[model samples]
Target: MRAILFVLLLLPALCFGQAAKQKDNPITIGTKQTFHSAILKENRTLWVYVPKSFTAGSKLRYPVMYLLDGEAFFTSMVGTVDYLSALGKMPEMIIVGIESTDRVRDLTPTHSPFWASGEPANDLKTSGGGPNFMAFLEKEVMPYIETRYQTETYRMLVGHSLGGLTALHALVNQPALFTSYVAIDPSVWWDNQLILKQAQKALPQKGSAGKSLFFATANTMNKGMDTVRVVQDNTQGNHNVRNSLLFRETLRKSKNLAWAWKFYPEDNHGSVPFPAQYDALRYFFNKYALDKDLNDSTITVDYIKNHYRAVSAMLQYPVLPAQGTVNSLGYISLGKKQYAKAYQFFKMNLENYPTVGNLHDSMGDYYVKIGDKKKAMEAFRKALSLEEVAETRKKLKELEAGR
Candidate 1:
């Protein structure tokens, strides 16, 4: 039954691969999916990036990060996740970039025919669609992704500029929608500081939905001005920086939320997202890396188990030991002629990943080492039934011939 569940989990990857072959060797970083929205009455395009390490039929589930302004930042975000997760700085997570159809209409929370600098403009007619956009996310987009993907309950929201305003809007309005928020260069100056005022009041209240937040503002001020001077400037042209500083001050009363803020003296609005995204991910998963080496003979199974339990607690999800890590330990133990240690490692891996056919094949190798022909044949057969590995079949035939 567990093996069947494992195959079911791998089925999406296998099917995705076969369908992708219909394309003629195209270079791709993420897959574009269609999301039909009932609230918005439109079909939206969604960009999804699943880590390559996760496509191998493993049962490992990942937290999902919903990125706003995906059309601009999707590729860079994928590279950041790939680089950090490879070095064990953070866990590999699924990234879903929400591509926008009507940028200003979807991201802005209120309607005003004026710019943040308070200049009147005629192009703001389609504003105030944030409520519908939020509805589309919570009622349609999120449910679609959650139902189809192997995701944990912990979710992160990321955005910049107008998209950043929407990120804070979600936190202020629908606090439980995402577990954390990354609002880089957010336009709290929108609607004449509507969201900024609401956040100031709501963010300080007890049991506020925003449990975690990372706020960042770029150096959009005058060349000589720093964050302190910009806040006191009160010039109409200094609206964005001023609003950001005011919002940053909200953290003083927001002791209930785990939060951080930064002022990038070097990066402007166009460049701050890159550094802020990197820092925000590091902050979220600061304790994800294991302290001890799993391959060391001195470490026991109990330590590995406890380490991942701590990881699960930090992530607020049920994270299990990765099949690859445990398998490496098993193979290393086997190389040292430590059969008992090898057996323990293999058992620990198989217990965590029952649906993995590769683990069953490894177990057959261990049974053969112990000179148990009957058990070896049984393990090989079971391994073959779950996954058709050539080595498992070859060993099974040899055991039968010996009989």
Candidate 2:
């Protein structure tokens, strides 16, 4: 009898839990959205991941990251951004992973009959459609994402293999399309180093200037050979890495762009994307680690403002101080009896979030800490006017009665 009653009692709760999950909680990282591209004449799939802080009514905007090979690496990229942004190592981003339909036709710049082994192949007849694919991305995919989401002007491109080749093509020809590019183990030997020559011409002429790039090379050399020996060897299997190094030299000519490269001997072509992308993110946002600089005694309001201003300038996007972070900093200062610093932080939060009742309440706490009853009353009144809270009402009443 008790077991029957227990099951009956739990049935509603279990059903409610299931219904809630089905309604509000998504089981996957993000929704699979489709857009029909007139440029490519097909429906393209986008696996997009927005930050946890994203909400329908929120005014916060974020940079966008367009990743190639969505089906293969979307989850990993989402996890990377989530972890790094949570730690203040980088800004939260909207990751748009593009799933490939006809990769060879879309990624390769010039159609080639020869394989990577310098031998003729029959399957690559659809090669060299990358220009149209790029148009699909720029015209269709980008406009779709930007119009649907609240995004900053800053955008980043990430690709591997043939996708990486497309990224370099964009960097050389359409440099202004994205703010940063991460090309991992790029197939630079494609179409007889077509992009390599373009880069050689464009890079010296201020191509990719004022932009950020991080390209990685994997260990694609022959057996019993190191980098130097492999570069010296002109064998068919070594064309990719050799041309990659050649592109690296070309990248050095462009003093205007911020670029970094690493050769991964431990990781081969198939196994380098995860670690390479992780490192690429670090290279892209190296100066975004605020925890290293923030401490109880050393950090000031002016320094925090300057740090975000630098980030804004570097990314060419406006970023404001996070309200929660500043609030915590204010309380931290208050705990340390640094009244002036506490007041500055609280005031900054109020300025950033003027309509947030909690911020006005925090300001009331700050005024009370400094024993300024008049200002404290004003703050409590403002907080109460925004939203009625029992604690704020009590504080206002106590101040009004001169207690």
Candidate 3:
């Protein structure tokens, strides 16, 4: 029964390796070799998604999420990451989808007869390999990713169902391994809820200020239903809902360990990953995504001008956008000795940012360049009065010298 279900569930995902050979848009699918285990000879296949902004000129490095069940989950995760990152709702980061060699053997912590009924041996069963799997990830996989890509120290670990259980195990046993955790519908029933018991015993007694964990679950079996048949019908589970809620409650009363948890009664196990992955991304970069620091006011005139020259085609230069993204096109035109273009941007910026002295001053610089000294002096004098900075003072001095 369970054995048949396991095999059936396993084949499609295993066959996904062949399908992964076909690339999806903006996502590069590939494999890597790591000597993570001797018994598992083949290393692992990893799917990677590098954002469009990850060009040669980009100076930004991104955080990472090492996801399990790559064969089934990689494509959707990549898509969500791409959409969110482009919208600036989340920081651009790499998604590393790690495929398993043999999930039944590796993803589980301890060996038992519940799932493997045919051959239950003392110590020789092809189970209890999770520790070695974790070793492969921690030692080989993580180091390889860090070395090959521009990654930051902040890392996230994400897993679904059994993978979810793996993430929780990592959290309790190796708490310092990752900065964030997104566990979707983890199997608390594994080994008679061994993980739940472990969590209860080894629970940390601290608030989650420095670290974060976002746990979620979907609607599992509804009361009197046969879970196995229901799983086959819907191809999902809701068991994690109860477990995630319980986990949240446990953490709430424990006094430490920062945590965020939600239950989606509307979502099932298979469908939960989509929304959960997106929400996890928001949670990870919530503070930085809405930051107004990078808006027009805080940027240097030179920097804006430089940016305008490069991104004007994308931003449609000189309209002086007041909201959404800052317009660097206008600023860039000013820097490139394009006096007319610079004036166009300056005037447009002035319409929205009229109180901002820099826009007027910039327009005045353009006026002086085109031999309109009166307008240039007016712009510079306004800038001087609004706020005297080194660049503005220098411009004022230049105007005085010209007179």
Candidate 4:
């Protein structure tokens, strides 16, 4: 009888463990979606990475990063953003990686008979469809993503190789589309430096006051030749390096836009994107870091508000401290018995995220700690109204019964 009872007792725990594992197994990092494009006249598969903080009903909206060469770069970019945002080096963002059907066709701005090496570029016969591709993004992709996802006004565009060429093309021809541009080892030598020439003329005329760009090139010289030697030698193989420098100089002379460039001697074209993407993101968000000495005594609601207000001005959109940040700070204060500071942080979060049930629940906990039973009940009631979770409902019932 004791053996049977032991087995019966073990069965419930085993079943519960299995159920918990089953529930957790289906959780994913991100999701894949398909959208039919009227402009491209085909369906495109998109890889999307929503931040961990994103919830279905939350009022929070995130900036979106549209990555080119999605099949190659999507996972790396998602990992990079996820890691950095967790460190607060940058804000968590939504990543949308658009898969390509015909890369050369979609990435090249002008059709050319000769390659960057001045050889007959027969492989680019169907090139010069960049305008149409941009149209597809502007008309179809952006709208579709905005409709389906919670996105803010700030958007970033990232590309590599042929995709880098397209990113530069967009910057020159359509500067208003993205807030920042990152082009890694871009093939700017296409069509005898056609895009570079266009950039020299168009970029100045367009007035890139609020725009930011970071472009980098890898060492493409012969084994013996350095950057200076390759430029002086001007070999066909040097066309890419030479044209990229010219493009950089042209933009520098324009002097209207915020731009930065880096050359990696140790990294070649294929290996450059790994570090380049990380650096580009860091460079664009360089001002996002908070003062390191900040502590519970120094933190104030106005200081937090003002910091984000400045961030809003820089990003051209209203942004606030993440709900998680506020909640964590609130709890940290409460744990230290800093009731006033804890209440301030919690109240600020409630003001920012009025609809979030957890914020109300946290505020109730804060009130209870400060021995304010009436306010605690009010907060608990608010939480129960927003969500009928058992713990919150039980807390409310206990409070009511005690009265």
Candidate 5:
């Protein structure tokens, strides 16, 4: 009777485990390909998904995202890419899921034991081959894809769990490997967090100018106990977010480079990738918006004006530049001696950042030079409306006198 009761008591757990491991619904995509990597000398397969409208016209090459754990993730990622691209939330890109037939041998950096507890086992002997895998992608896989498809130079890499660890390993050890990297719930606990330590030592303290990386983690249950605490520790544990934060802060103080890091506390090991992947894609494309017009001399003030005008028309509303991009563009315009363009940017800046007294004050001077008394009065009035210090008050008084 006790034995039967024990089996009954464990029924739910058994059912849940089976459900969790069941093969996910097969995702259908627009295209798929399989090939061997000359660099790693392994047979690799990649799935490609182009949106319905993609083939209608234009030889448009797209940014590519190379994903790990292809069999399980290919369809979901294709769905994400399709939905996000259609909504204009992310740039359209080719989905390249590298299906690994030998996961254990290809994903790890070193030949090491699976557990930190020092358990003996030949059952898991096929381990540790990350460097070669990276080489396979770089030398064999990338070349094949680029040659066969409409591809842009902009590339992104993504991995989950062990794959995420492998992605991180590639980034720190091979900084030039990809333009952007997204690692979700990376097994930072792997190999005693050896890769984490390597990241600490390898992350450049300055000049992240063209490089980007996004790493995230999810909660995992430990021994049937809600492993929230352990996962939380991992999220905050190695200071992964904080380390990246400190790196960003240090870079800021030194004016080193551009990088962003974020934390996702809601997802556990299996569920975190969904959000991280979307955000990472947006982050990368926005950071590196390619110039369709490559001719430097053709990129004139008139060009910028036309672009913004088109933006306004397309949105059917005044498209104000965000304060930061506008501020940078304003200064660049002024330095380039494109007065009219500079004025447009400064005016937009004033609209977005009305409380900024300095912008108004600067606009006042520009208006005065242009002999627009009415506009100058408006600018001076806006400036004086703010908390006026002695210096600004004096400037306001001077403008009021029409001098």
Candidate 6:
């Protein structure tokens, strides 16, 4: 009897411990994925960051940001993007961080014996593989991501240092690969300003009307030099800044590309990437703001639709307001006794998402408010067919009994 009582008492504790463990499980930020790349002829590891709103079953698709030097910047980029999106500065996106196997070999666009210092550097012997790396991204990596993930048409590329050089190369050579490019302090002096020279010739020839680019440079000049002195001195230490300025000027002359450049005097090469990334996101998504008071009588369904329509055109993708947002607007209008406005919102939801059960239920509620008993019955029946909920079934039964 004593042994049985002891065992019985311990069973509840064990069950409670299991339940607590399940409830307290840690949430993961992202996942690591690997695949064999035929172009690179090696296994490539990718760090994928999905937004908090992402769900495996949802039909929603997100824009993608491909960040170079994934191992170094994935966590920070994820945090930055999430924070900015939560504040409505930009849309939430998926981040794909591409880890580097050989930084010099994959990031350099030309095979040259000279380094950024304009001196012979034998370490560049394995360089000039940027074309191959881009091929890997276009042929292998992008296909894998598109097929495996729910992605939108808009894509952005981000890089720093040598990786920034790679991003510029992609923007110049493979302009169609991404919609926007962010190059933070790119090593434009690589091979004695080869990319700068290339950009002058390529950007105008290709026509960059629809694409966007944000490039920033740090205070890489020598201790005594300012912007003017750096350009005039043309010293080896000042080559990076000079090359970046030249590239910026070349881009400015092109009327086709929507571009922005910034010079951060307080940040060095190491410290510039973080703030540069933040500013780049802000610049790219400058048009994606919805400044409206939801409670105001002036707010209408047309206003919301027009705002998102403009955003959709900017992103070149169909962007819609969230379902919950429309639903909330409907309820707010209903509470204010604005029957026409409430009907417009509820009708817009039905048009956008015909299969959503809650939307149909809300539509039924709106019909009931307008004293349309027949339409109310139809909406409630549609909602019950989509989802067999007890409340909807009860509402349908009550309507049928009245008939």
Clashing pairs in 4: none
Q: Write the per-residue lDDT of candidate 3 for residues 239-279, one digit (tens) a residue.
A: 44444555665666654565777767678888999898888
Q: What lDDT score goes with residue 234 in model 2?
A: 79
Candidate 5 lDDT over 357-402, as tens digits, reads 7788777766766678788777777787864756667766776786
Task: Rank candidates, lDDT, best first.
Answer: 6, 2, 4, 1, 3, 5
C-alpha lDDT values of all predictions = 0.84, 0.88, 0.68, 0.86, 0.66, 0.88
- Model 6 worst lDDT window (10 residues): 113-122
Which structure is stronger by TM-score: 1 or 4? Answer: 4
After superposing candidate 1 on the true structure, give the runs of residues whose Cα lies further than 4 Å from its correct spot: 1-24, 51-60, 86-88, 208-210, 235-239, 295-298, 336-339, 367-377, 391-403
Error of 5 at 157 (Å): 0.3
**Which of candidates 2 and 3 reaches a greater TM-score?**
2
Residue 401 in model 4: shift from native, Å? 7.0
Model 5 clash tally, residue pairs: 4
- Scanning candidate 3 in windows of ten residues, the lowest lDDT window is 314-323
TM-score of 2: 0.87
TM-score of each: 0.83, 0.87, 0.62, 0.86, 0.57, 0.85
Of the two candidates 3 and 4, the one with more favorable lDDT, higher being better, is 4
Q: Give model 4's TM-score versus the native structure.
A: 0.86
Off by over 4 Å in 6: 1-24, 364-403
In model 2, the clashing pairs are: none
Error of 4 at 211 (Å): 0.9
Q: What lDDT score is found at residue 143 in candidate 2?
A: 91
- Which scores higher on lDDT, 2 or 4? 2
In every candidate, how many clashes are there? 0, 0, 10, 0, 4, 0
Candidate 2, 1-403: lDDT as tens digits: 9999999999999999999888995567787998788999889899999888886677889999999999999999999989998988889999999999989899988889777676787888898898899898888899999999999999999999988988888888889999999999998878777788888888888645569999999988888777787778878777677888888899889858899989998999999999998999999899876654445578889878998898888778888877777898899999889999999999998888898888999999999999999999999989998889998899889889988
